[model samples]
Target: MEQHHPSLRSEALALLRSGVTNREVAEKLGVPRGTVGWWLHEDRKARGVVVAERPHNCPRCLSLPINRPAYAYLLGLYLGDGHIVAKGKQNHLSIYCCDGWPGLIDDAEDTMRKVLTGTNTGRRAKIGCTEVKSYSKHWTCLFPQHGPGMKHQRRIELSDWQQEIADGFPWELVRGLIHSDGCRFTNWTTRMVGGKRKRYEYPRYYFTNKSDDIRKIFTDTLDRLGVEWRTLARGSDPYNISIARRPSVALMDAHIGPKY
Candidate 1:
């Protein structure tokens, strides 16, 4: 936004030449993207440097995962509880997971790193959650399922690539979605049999989302993994979709335990 030092200006151009996107260069240099763009063009022109038409980063460099476990996990997080904020010409993705389980946060962060490859990742603390965030216009490219308004208010479908990832690593995807917007906890019930009170406890999982499409993705992944889950309410509103079945609980526990 303000004047930059001569060295910093040259550094910005160098970053561009090295395959960094203009938006990223500006952010890294702590300046506006327009400034970086104009300065780079002027300097290149003055030096008789023939610049490529596209100021955007290289296609190969921007190529993130299309069908990988990390990408699938990130997708599930985005579908379940992530939001993208478009700030001017840049887009930032933020996914918040409850602090009750730090493993969820770790998984989300690891997924981001594995997918984004070389981008800067950011995090923040919320009242009851931890946030994993990153800024990149390419995020939109990675997640084509994004749309205007809330997920429940809009319909978004998975692309063919996403379907492939879902089919291949359904567990990671299912775990991410459930971790962000669902819960794995103990369920206890008491009954009077033959005038005696008895109590039984079992582990159950619940995945909740307002979007039918998102809910379907979660359940579909479970189905692929042979994990049983049920829609708690047929036509009425229950809290979330439930997976209280014993076999399902054991299967999930083997993979996704309480994220402590």
Candidate 2:
């Protein structure tokens, strides 16, 4: 049998424990990041290393209470496949609509109304609706109707009266609603595709949540909903978003009805 490179593996584990990034360790070891991860995994099995411990401080700002996952979820919504058309200086709101989305105009209006109203309590209300005025802004919906290069239809912006309704919501509720709305919108896009063609089209659906408040609400809601979520590392590269396929039907049965 060939001699095992235990020393190299130990060195890799040491590097990981020393706060060196996997990429850096991989570079030093002349191997892929996956290789580093594999080495660490093997060492964990052999040495009985437990790596699931939580940190005392936050991961994003690293202040306290460990709320980084929330920030990451929000950032993901901002960076993922979406459009941020010019709205005003130092201000732009992002919007994303998928091809498989049913009743595009209606959904957009529903989202707008929810963000403006601040509650998901009504019989016909969608989750993430909020009565927060500070967060509401003029947003346009662009969807393909007949074919390519179609004229983009503009949905009516929130009116002054609607703004009055939104202004009534508390600040915390407003933040929660916006974050939850982003999650709902992103989840909808992910589930929109169907059939054999879906294999090729499914992965394109994405959302980024760049705000601290947005991230916290999303992860907290996910935890409350008992859904699995992961935080991504910072980089210029894109991250994959995957939802558990087994839970889809059950989740839908719990909230969505035939009318939805």
Candidate 3:
């Protein structure tokens, strides 16, 4: 290991303690990124800093203005396929997105960051999906719907403030839900036209979830937006909401069409 000047080490530590990334500090100080990381590690070890969570700018805790639209969208995603784990010094919120749709994955991570400013995000690859995660102790504070069991097995309801945000940005909420757990596809049938068979196609949207409360929340937002939907049963259980009406599909296409 090459030795650096004492003054350079002090400057690097100062920049790092002020929230600069290891790469940024290294470039600024003309040091290797690995050396910057090693310095930070030693400094924390010597100071007994067991946890190095960055400073959190939780809107709820700081009484700061929230990006309500982003929050609403993130809330919908949470209800569809997100979870928060806050146990024994481990705290984070994770939203799973299919790997094929890189755009959705990026959107999910971006929205999480927007909702909880100053939080750090990471990605974990599953068999066929990517988990976009953000770390912060206050995730539970924002998502009271999190509980001890699966979402379907527990009651899920938004707080009054969350409700207000959802009401104000219903389309974003619907978009988020669809982006996470819903899809838009075309259905086709054959019709005789001028003695020739012609295939006719129409587009419809479906939002599926096992949690009845979550489905109701999605439908309630649709009701407010005047987008008609019907519940459908999957294997003898109601698990899908279908939006096929022409006018409603048009409305959906205008605001929250197929996931990109």
Cα RMSD, each candidate: 5.8, 22.8, 5.5
**lDDT by residue (tens digit), candidate 3, 1-260:** 78999999999999989999999999998999999888998999999889655577888888999999899889888998899988855589999999888999999999998999888899999999999999888898899888898999988888899999998999999999999889999988999999999999999999999998999999999999999999989789999999999999999999998877
| Models sorted by lDDT, best on top | 3, 1, 2
lDDT of each: 0.79, 0.38, 0.91
Q: Write the per-residue lDDT of candidate 2 for residues 1-260, one digit (tens) a residue.
A: 23338787778889988988889998997767888877777767888877763322212233223222222222222222223344432223333433333343244334434332331211222343212111222222111111222112222222343223323322222222333332332222323345333322221112244434334444454455554555554585223232334464245224321212
User: Which regions of candidate 1 fall more than 4 Å away from where they truly are?
Assistant: 1-67
Please say which candidate is ahead in lDDT: 2 or 3. Answer: 3
Q: How do the predictions measure up, each by TM-score?
A: 0.75, 0.26, 0.80
Better of 1 and 3 by TM-score: 3
Clashes of each: 0, 22, 0
**Candidate number that wins on TM-score, 1 or 2:** 1
TM-score of 1: 0.75
